[model samples]
Target: MSEPEIRLQAWETHIEEFGTQQYGLSFDTLIKAVGKGPRAAHKLARRLKKSGRAHVVRIDYGSPGPWRNSKNFDEPGAAPHGPLWMFADRQIAWGYLEFDPGEWHPKASTAAHLTAVTELRLALTGLDTDPQVWTSERLLRRRLKTESGLAGIHIHDAWFQDFADPDKVWAVEVELSRKFGDGRLTRSLSAALEAAERNDLCGVLYFVRGDGLRRAVEGAATRLAHQRNLDRLPNLEIHDLDATLARKGVR
Candidate 1:
């Protein structure tokens, strides 16, 4: 792993270490450990979640954090410009919010959890094979880019290390997301492409949920994934939300 990637990995491991002792955390508490502000906190949180070592909860505690006289937890950023908390590992760890009760619901709990499992498992490499499972009503969270008061949710899943098709990693992101005008989905695809051009491990796979993006991104991703596999990584692939999930089970 590169220096930055190494550091990123270490930080996630740290969260897992601490998270094991606790159960969940508010953004404020995490700020102390990962640093303050949405970007920094988000960066760390995304890595933890993507790395499969943690689970993140977007808590709505009114406009500003500190949630003076708080009420209840809800969807992450459900009300905009709200504090989101990172909960680690199967509701067994904490990211920072150690005091507040995490937002809880039943409607999509099963699918949501399966989604988490599907996502985190992506980080696995080598012979970590377990039969793919089935899930429904799940969504692959999108990574946030550009600064905004209303930030898009950031999600991290897995990155594969490859050299034969350095740009192959880019295909993963390309395979995800059926549509997002103005390269919203393309940016990630580009990042992977750049990695492959450098001959780095292009094992990373991207999974985008929703339609339109499917034809657009997948059309390009499939061809690239096929070509890259021919060049190297015969077993690797760049798949959209459904295919990737189907490979695992539900989709």
Candidate 2:
């Protein structure tokens, strides 16, 4: 196989070879490192997609700068559950919950989701595992401006892209909490499920605060999952904060 083909194979093998499905391999890096022609590289990508050996997802490398909010959203502890500005800002910092402006006080359980993702990453870090967690933050923002324009708009916390290969990519949106934050977990999961199905995402994962809310959110996520006829895109998974973190060894 050619060098580009080798690179593609390496990337697709990342999950089993590394830990995260996220492949930070630069396109430029490949051009210089692998003495493959442009046509060869493109062909390799096409083959990867056709073979289901890998997939692609938009990535957002958020710019670095302090967050700005007209209503002092940047103010500390503004959100009742967490910081409302987490999503408002262009960057994805450390936070469990991300505020959503679409619905009345909507929030996504990023804490549980990220905790699970990080756990999986940590567990497979040393040996042979590689499942990448990619961000389409930048692309999403640019899209906001291109589509939504200069005017302020509600931001969707973070768009997590799951790409196993060029043909097996998925987008995951997390919904957490039933009361106070966000409109309704059921509705939130529904929207995510809808979007994921439209795109190539495997499915949505709903992480509730506790098992008490599990049935409600899971039912919602599962129903949405089935309605879209997507059994894989948005796999409904509920996570309890305390227990999930403890199990993952995050203190």
Candidate 3:
């Protein structure tokens, strides 16, 4: 392939890989994924848009409501803030088109979480042992329905296979807020750990926002450890999300 073709192919792959998982990709996220400066990334996005492979969703962060197409900003009360790229009909025909922006609008927090997860996935590329493949929660849930022997398993936010070792897989959970109010967190963690063991995952990696959340997870792990044999349990690692993102220049 020619140089330009190669670059375009990489952009398309990145868009399909990340967009299918998160429903859409924020402008900044795309820029990071493509490893290009803003101007270059903008050009690439324009080319994709022109080819009818993608469309831009204008988001009004202040309004915290449904996103509209970039061409629909003339409507009354419309306040465009940022652009989110989604697959167009041409691209959607390739499959993995489970999300429909018109039918289901994501809450502001939900959108932010999805962006964070995408950013984390991009940041992993900077590591020595990056992820070879990433499976989002949406895909995991879909698999549970069709794949046998996956019943009664709790799905994590995402799962990734190690680039260095194809057999090594990890379950990722991104927690931005406290979800342990009524023993719910413990139960969720227990299920995830059990699922890891059953699926032969290397371990569970929890990316939590605050120290309090990290401590809560640690407390839960300690309790689980007491209940089960520690030597036989899979590894559980709690990381500070802010620190991790900062280290990767994502913050």
The whole-model lDDT of each prediction reads: 0.42, 0.39, 0.67
TM-score pick, better of 2 and 3: 3
Best model number under lDDT: 3
Tell me how far the alpha carbon of residue 246 in candidate 1 is from the true structure, in angstroms, after superposition.
Answer: 5.2
Q: Write down the worst ten-residue block by lDDT for model 1.
A: 134-143
- Sorting all predicted structures by lDDT, with the top scorer first, yields 3, 1, 2
TM-score against native, each model: 0.33, 0.38, 0.73
How displaced is residue 131 in candidate 2, in Å? 13
lDDT of each residue in 137-250, candidate 2, tens digit only? 333444556664654543333344343454444443333445435546556665665555555456554444567676676666566666678763335445654465466543
Q: What is the lDDT of candidate 1?
A: 0.42
- Model 1: residues >4 Å from true position, as ranges? 1-157, 161-179, 183-187, 220-236, 246-251
Q: Which lDDT tens digits does candidate 3 get at residues 4-122?
A: 53235754655555665555677777677666676666676677666555665555455443544444223466655655544444345245444332433444557667777777876
Clash list (residue pairs), candidate 3? none
Give residue 76's lDDT in candidate 3 (0 to 100).
67
